[model samples]
Target: MKYKYILFDADDTLLDFGKAEWFALNKTLEDIKFNCNKYIAEKFSSICDKLWHEFKLDEPLNRYVQINYHDLYYKYSVERFKDLKELLDINISAQLLSEKYLNSFSECGFLVKGAENVCKQLSLQYKIFVVTNGLSHVQKSRIGNSKIKSYITDILISEDAGCAKPGKEFFDYSIKSLGTSNLSEMLIVGDSIITDIFGGNEYGIDTCLFNSKRKINKLKIQPKFEIRELNELLGILRI
Candidate 1:
């Protein structure tokens, strides 16, 4: 059956997030006069991932927090990276470092190969929405600066959507936002098996696993289709 709407995960699925992250991290390090090293990058990524994991555990995103989400996220990053703190002056706040990283990320508009081609092609026949989970400002800036935004009808970042993926509330919001309850008419495509595939399965929508790395899926959940590249999506849609 043909899918009427396509829900896409923005990061690795369509955008080159790894490259963006690396660029942003390097810029942040340089801006803050911290020595750039692999260890630092890994540590930053690890801390951010851990904080995001914790953040996702709480549903209805807003109800789970007391402080500003960005402040909390940067607070953890600064505290975890003691080296950076030692290097930074006493007056510099962790929030400033976080701001540097995000601004750098916003400046870099890296997209996966054939991302625009696929999205533009799919947008002609199917309503395409970016169902991403990340900072609203950063994600919006990246999309706004990139050509991919032209192919999307709307974007739903978890920060603004009030829920994170793999949670039923997220999908419910998307469905309700689009005024559709027919889950069968939509397809959820993303690189993450745990969030994208599992979320789609749990939400009763068809899942397309964009396994760019061709990694093994240890999860019990199975996607309806798997593609190695963005261009392959066209074939899946039989365009």
Candidate 2:
């Protein structure tokens, strides 16, 4: 393998984030006496997806951005309930809903299939770093509880990094933290075309898109490599 450092995305790439998000959101809504269904889940996910996409584009030092972003997502989620205006009125803060969701999400430990095995095996030959964009506390809790925690050399969250993915600042900070300036020796593997692929591509590093769902690449940018399975990365390293 040519790469000395491997930066792994922690969400859908390694952890089953969709499940965690769904569980946390529904659980939070349940606490507030709201009945949630698949329709609400889908709407919440869509709203969150947009927020995260925007987050990945800019650097915000205030951690309040994370809270406020989630609040906005929750507000949109509440909008789906037509008659719930009376129950989920102005008094209901997005911050409250976000805090509830984070609390519930932190307890989730759903890993993608073969994530631990792949990480364990890769750690032997290459330095593995988890690069993620989310609340530091929430990301830390989930990563700490995951089976692959021991295998990761470090966990870099956007909250602590002062920036998110697709932005060169985050990657630059990561490079400095790792004490390496050789971008050519680093490889980034992630699920997001906008974040993982675009970030690595912009930062001058090799990138591998982990399209577990086999989604087509509609974006103009393309990754150096693409894999449908986590373990398939091992084969990429062999050559």
Candidate 3:
């Protein structure tokens, strides 16, 4: 009720990340003459999630990406034809996969239910910002192409800020960029407890965990609030 700034998470919280990732990866695998089966896709998701969790635990970005891909390749025995470098050949494979993912991701632009409307309504009273752990170009592309872009006051991506979420530095950068000195006058809304909620809590900002899936197990780190729908924010904000 006292917040003047509202920060949001980009991936699953705002955008339908799972849908986009599935479409892109499936298409990319098919294009590369690989079987894009559900099992493979699920495996890839698990691998990516683990890598991200490691990143949250303070692994360097470069090492995180490299190790993740390397492990995936190893697990799939993808080096039968060539080495990891040859298999990943950025220009041919990595870049293509990234582009495909971004394209599919940008094309969908599906916001959680009431997200756009909430942004529009909240924009009248609060300055809205997006704090995400992602490449700047990719995050910017998604934001610029999304319906909520017009309502957002600013966006802070990890690549541009040289830090990722759950890190105090990234939250500091976001606070500075928002030109707000009172941490209590800010709220962070996101789906990830380890990233969004924990990061915001570290910065002394109120956090609302968007647990839409209702999958969060018993955890020690409790968010200030939890909601299953974006519209539920109205109740918390008293809008």
Task: Indicate which candidate wins on TM-score.
Answer: 1
Error of 2 at 89 (Å): 7.1
| Candidate 1 total steric clashes | 0
Measured by lDDT, the strongest candidate is 1
Write down the TM-score of every candidate. 0.83, 0.80, 0.76
lDDT of 2 by residue, 17-114 (tens): 88888888789888888888988777666665564455432333343443354344345443433223333452466656656777889877789998
lDDT of each: 0.78, 0.77, 0.72
Error of 2 at 86 (Å): 5.9
lDDT over C-alpha atoms for residue 165 of model 1: 72
Candidate 3 runs further than 4 Å off: 29-40, 46-108
Estimate the overall C-alpha local distance difference test score of candidate 2. Answer: 0.77
For candidate 1, write residues 1-239 as lDDT tens digits.
46899999999988899999899889877876766788877867776676556654333225344224444555555554444555434346666776777789887668999898998899889999888877788888888888888888888876676656766667877888777888889999999887789888987899999999989988688999999988988987888
Backbone clash count, each prediction separately = 0, 0, 0
RMSD of 3: 5.5
After superposition, which runs of candidate 2 have C-alpha atoms over 4 Å from their true positions?
30-36, 46-93
Write the residue-wise lDDT of candidate 3 on 73-182 in tens digits. Answer: 32332222122225334345444455555555555566777888999899999999988876566677788878999999998987666666676667777878988688
